[model samples]
Each structure stands twice: as structure tokens, then as C-alpha cells.
Target: MPKYILFGDYCENALEKRTPYRQDHLEGLKQQKETGILVTIGPTKDNTKVFGIYDAENAEQVTELIENDPYWKNGIWTDYEIKEWIQAF
Candidate 1:
């Protein structure tokens, strides 16, 4: 499995609207982890962005996961970047 990192940029009002969608978002990540695709996920200290590590065959798989997220579809996330990660540890 290849490891990749995803960076999600929040919309201007994302924080204000997060409460309603938060549970769904968390549930989605939990499902991904249970399915053995997600490695780890969380927001930055300021909550302006979120970063996730995923285990997938390639960048396309990780992109599909991001595209399927509630946050992405519901407009909470405005943009994203994905890159293959090489863990030294």
C-alpha cells in the first residue's frame, strides 16, 4: 500500500457550519478507517485546515476518498491537495 497525504482547505464559513456536518464527517472517516483505507485524520490547531494520511494504491484512490467526503460535497472544503508521502520512520 502507498501512503498519501491530503490537505483540505476550509471555506470561509466552514467553522460556523461545521456543527451540523461534523458528525457525518467523522463517521465517514471512521468508515474509511474500518475499511482499511484511512490511516489517520484530523484538523490543524486553528481548524482552518485538515490533513489526513491514507493507505491506498495511488493518488487516484486517495482523491476518490476525498471526493466522497461529506465536507467536500457539502461545501465545507473549498480546495484540496494530495501528494504521495514517504515516511522515513
Candidate 2:
């Protein structure tokens, strides 16, 4: 499996409205974790940005998975960047 880093910022308005869908989004992420896809996820301490890492087969597959996220579907994240990552440590 290849590792990927997903970087993005949440939409201000959407973040305010995302509480209702948080559980669903978490459930989806939980499934991914069980499948060994999600490595870790969290928002920056300041809460201005969000980022996550995942182990997937490829970028396309990862992108597909991200597109299915409840947050993404609900417009919580309006912009994002996905890139292959190498963890040398």
C-alpha cells in the first residue's frame, strides 16, 4: 500500500453546519480505518486547516474514497490537495 497526504481547509459556513453530519463522517472514516486505509486524521490545532494521511493502493483510489466522504459530499471541504507521501522515518 502507498501512503498519501491529503491537505485541505474546511469551508467556514460548512464547518458551522457540519455538526449534524459529523457522526456519519466519522463512521465512514472508521470503516476506512478498519480496512487499513485511514492512517490518521485531524484538524490543525488552530482549527484553520485540516489534514489526513491514508494508506491506499493509488492516488485515484484515494481520491475516489475522499469524494465519498460525508464531509466532502456535504461541502465541508471545498478545496483539497492529494499527494503521494513517503515517510522515511
Candidate 3:
């Protein structure tokens, strides 16, 4: 498996809009966590961005995981990116 980083920028008013889908979003993360694909996930201190590290076979697989998230489907995440990560010792 390869490691990848995921980043998402919330839309304007995303905080208020995210309430309904928050639980679903969390459930999705839980599924990934159970599979051991999600490494770590959280919001930035400022709450403007969300980021996570995931272990998957490839970038496309990670992208699918992100695309299926409720936050992404419901437009809470206005924009996002997935980058293959290379951890340095």
C-alpha cells in the first residue's frame, strides 16, 4: 500500500451546511478506519481546511474514497486534492 494525503477546502457557509451530513461523513471515515485505510484525519485549527493521510493501493483508490464522502457529495467540501505522499525519515 502507498500513503497519500487528502486536503479539502470548505465552501462558504460550509460549517452551517455541514450539520446534516456530519454524521454520515463520520460514518464514512469510520468505515475507512475499520479497513485500516485511514491513517489520520482532522480539521485544521482554523477550521478552514481538512486533511488526512490514508494508506491505499493507489491515488485513484484514495480519490474514490474521498469522492464518496458525504461532505464531498453534499458540497461541504468545495474543493479538494489528493497527493501521493513520500514520508521522509
Number of the top TM-score candidate: 3
Q: Write the per-residue lDDT of candidate 2 for residues 1-89, one digit (tens) a residue.
A: 88999998887765577898899999988999999999998887766577999998999988898898888898887778999999999
* Tens digit of per-residue lDDT, candidate 3, span 1-89: 78999988987777799999999999989999999999999888777899999999998998898888888898888788999999996
Give candidate 1's TM-score: 0.91
Off by over 4 Å in 3: none
Lowest summed-lDDT stretch of 10 residues in model 1? Answer: 11-20
Sort the predicted structures by lDDT, highest score first. 3, 1, 2
TM-score versus the correct structure, for each prediction: 0.91, 0.92, 0.93
lDDT of 3: 0.90
Judged by whole-model lDDT over C-alpha atoms, candidate 1 comes out at 0.88
Candidate 1's residue-wise lDDT over 8-88, tens digit each?
Answer: 888876778777888988998999999999999888888789899999999999988888888888888889999999999
Candidate 3: worst-modelled 10 consecutive residues by lDDT: 6-15
lDDT, model 1, position 80 = 95
Pairwise TM-score winner, candidates 2 and 3:
3
Write the candidate numbers in order of decreasing TM-score: 3, 2, 1
RMSD to true structure for each model, in Å: 1.1, 1.2, 1.0
lDDT of each: 0.88, 0.87, 0.90
With candidate 2 superimposed using the best TM-score fit, by how many Å does residue 26's alpha carbon deviate from the native? 0.4
